[model samples]
Target: MSVDINNYNPTRVLVGVPYVNTVFHFIVGGGGTTLNLTDQISNDNSIGFGKGVAWIASDQAAILANIYTSTFSSWLSSQIWVYTQLPSTSLASTPTAIIPNSQQPIPSSISSELINIVSTPSGLVVLDVSGGILFI
Candidate 1:
C-alpha cells in the first residue's frame, strides 16, 4: 500500500510478506527499510499475517495494521497489535498494527476480519469480506 504522509511526502510504500511475517517501507526513488515484527511481538507469541495496513489520518507518523495470530495447536486465536516510531534511515524497526472503522452504523464490537483499508482526511474506512464497512 502507498500513503502520502506529509512528513514522508512524495510516496511511502509499504510491502508485507505474510508467510514470513515481514514488512518493508520503501521511499520512492530511495532505499527500502525493513520492519521487524519478531522482536516486537515475540513476547506475545503472535505471528503477523498482515490482513490490512494504513496510515493514521489523525497521526500520519503512525500506521495501523491488522494481524493474525495462532499457536498451530488445538486452539487458535487472532489479535491486533500497535507499534510506532519507524526510523527514517537504515536499521530495521517494529512493524505497526492497524485498526479500521467505517461510516456506516456498526456495533461497538467488530468481529469480522479486515479485507482492506483506506485513509481519508477524517479517518480510516475499513472494508471487511462480510461486506461490512466501518469508519474510524
Candidate 2:
C-alpha cells in the first residue's frame, strides 16, 4: 500500500507521513531547521494514519513536506528552503524547491546542505524516500 501524512500538527509537535525518495525542507523562527529522520519508531509502512489529508502523495514518487515546531510563532515565522528532488538517492533528480546561483551550474544531484530538517517539540516523524517532488 502507499503512504501519506496523517497528523502533521506543528503546534503540538507531531508531523509527516511515510514518503519515499522525497526531500523535505523546514523553517523555524524565520530560519531553517534540520530533521534527522529516525528508523527508531517503527519499520512497517503498513497501517493508515487517521487524521491528515492529502498533504503528501502516497505514490512511490511522492513527497510529504511540512513545518514542525513547538513554538507557534516559530512555526509561522520561518522561510522554507524547499528541495524537490532526492539528491542523495536519485541521480537524475532536480531540486524544484530552491533555485541555485546562476553563475554556478545546476548539478544533476541535490546538495546536502540544501536539505533542512523539520524542527518540532518531540514526536515520531516519517520518511519514505521513494520518489517525486515534495509537497505540503
Candidate 3:
C-alpha cells in the first residue's frame, strides 16, 4: 500500500508503507498544484510515519495523509492534513485524521505514530494504531 514516487520530482508525491517513515517535501502553488515527491530521510530513526497517501483535491486544496502527534508525549493518531496551502518544506507539518483505535481488540501501547496508509479508487485507507483499517 504505497505510492511509488522517487527522487525530487515536484509533479508526484510518495507516501511510504507502514514503518517506512517517509513523505515527500512540497512547494505549494497559489492554486493547488500537483504535490511533489522530493527528498526522503531514512537515517533519522528517531522519527517515522506509519502509513498514508496523498491526492490533489482541487486547484486550491490537497489531502496529505500521515501519522502524527502534537508532541513526543502525545498519542500518535492516524490523520490527514488538509492543505489550503502546502508547506514550502518541512517534516514537522500538522496532521489530522479519524482513528480506528476503538475497533481494535487490544489497544496499541506504543505512544508513537504507528499508522499505515494506502490509496484506492474509492479514497484513502488507513491502518490505525490498534491494527484496524479505516477508509477515509
Candidate 4:
C-alpha cells in the first residue's frame, strides 16, 4: 500500500512552525540590563533598573509583566527583544519589551504579565523573566 505524503496534515504541527505570528512554545523573561537604550548584546552589564528576569518566549500580541513601580514606562527607558519568528504579530509596532514600562522588573512571570492577551491587539508588552524561552 502507498500513502500520499502530501495528504499528511496536522493543525498543531503546521500552525506551530517558525512562521510569522507563530506563537513561541516557551515563555520569555530574563535579567539583562534594563536601563539599556540599545539592543547591543555586548552592553549587558547595565541590567539594573528592571533587572533580574528570565522566560521562554511565548506567543502573544504583547507581553505584559507586573513590574510596575510607577506609571510602568519610566525606569529603563527602553528595551530590546530577539524574536524567534519574523513578521511578528505586532502589525504596527516592532520588536519591543514584554512589559509596558521600561522601568520596573516584572512582578510576575511573562504568562501573567498582561491582564488579558486573548483580547489584546498586537504589539505584545512582554516580560522576559524565564529560562525556558532562552534555552529553547
Candidate 5:
C-alpha cells in the first residue's frame, strides 16, 4: 500500500519487475536534501535508469504551495518541467508514475516525492517534460 524509505542509499541498485497501477512516494527526511532516483546495476556498474521521480530541494514546497492554491494547471505545468529536465548521466529513467490532480498531504515533519502510477488497460504514463534540476 505505502512504503517509507528512511535512509535511501543512492548507490544501492534497485531491480524489480515493472509495476502497474502502483504509486510510489519517496518521503524526505528532516535533514534530507533531495531524493535521487537513479537506477544502478550491480553487474554492469552502469549507473543509469529511466523510471522514477527525483524531487529537488525546493520542489516539496513549490508543489505543496501550488496544490494548496487549487491551481492544477500551474502545478501540472511545473511538474512537467521538473520531470523532463532530469539529467541523463548516472540517473534513472523517467518515472512511470502519474501526478494526482489533487494534493495528498503527509506529515509536516517530513517532505516527500509522490508518484502515482496506473497501468492496466493502458500503457505506462511516465512524466517526461522539461525543468527542475535533477538531484544526483
Candidate 6:
C-alpha cells in the first residue's frame, strides 16, 4: 500500500503502525513540485514514527540501526538486502558526509562509506551503504 501527502496541509502529521506477529511493511512516497511531506503551516511532520521497539529515539543512528537490524538481521550481516530507492539528485546538492545524527556502536566489520547510489530514469535512485548494490 502507498500514502500520498500531496498538497496536504496540517499543523502536525504523525503515522503509526502497531506491532504485529506477521511480517508488515510500510511505504511512503512523495515527489513532484506539487507534493510535499511538510509545509510552513505545520510545526512538525513525522513519517513511519514508531514506539516500543529496541530503540527509543528518532535520530538517524537509532533509525538506521533499527532498519539495518530488522531488514538484514544485523548491520553487518553478509546477506544481500534491498531498501527503498531515493532520488539521487533530489537534494539541492550532494551531501558531504552521511553520518548518523547520534553516535551508536556499529560492528567494526561494517563498512562506513556508501558503496553505490544509482539514478533511474523514473526519477528514483538506489542507495547501498551496507556494501554492494542489490537491484530489485
- Could you arrange the candidates by lDDT from highest to lowest? 1, 3, 5, 2, 4, 6
- TM-score-best of 3 and 6: 3
What does candidate 3 score on TM? 0.37
Looking at candidate 1, the ten consecutive residues that score lowest on lDDT are 35-44
lDDT of 2 by residue, 18-66 (tens): 2321323222222325433322121122312111212221111222222
What TM-score does candidate 1 reach? 0.52
Candidate 6 has its poorest 10 consecutive residues by lDDT at 52-61
lDDT of 5 at 89: 27
Better of 1 and 5 by TM-score: 1
Q: What is the per-residue lDDT of model 1 for residues 59-129, given as tens digits with 9 covering 90 to 100?
A: 24333244454542321323333345544432134435433224333354654555566666676676665
**Clashes by residue pair, model 1:** 64-97, 64-98, 65-97, 65-98, 101-134, 101-135, 102-134, 102-135
Which regions of candidate 1 are displaced past 4 Å?
1-8, 30-48, 57-86, 90-109
lDDT of 5: 0.26
Q: In candidate 3, residue 86 scores what lDDT? A: 40
Please give the lDDT score at residue 107 for candidate 2: 44
> Distance (Å) between predicted and true CA of 63, model 2?
4.1
lDDT comparing candidate 4 with the true structure? 0.25
Top of the candidates by TM-score: 1
Q: Which residue pairs in candidate 6 have backbone atoms (N, alpha carbon, C) closer than 3 angstroms, thus clashing? A: none
* Candidate 5 wrongly placed segments (more than 4 Å): 1-6, 10-76, 80-89, 101-136
State the local distance difference test value for candidate 3.
0.41
The lDDT values for all models are 0.43, 0.25, 0.41, 0.25, 0.26, 0.23
| Candidate 6 lDDT (Cα, 0 to 1) | 0.23
What would the per-residue lDDT of candidate 4 be over residues 1-55, giving only the tens digit for each residue? 0011101111111111111212222211244222211111112222222122122
User: How high is the lDDT of residue 41 in model 4?
Assistant: 19
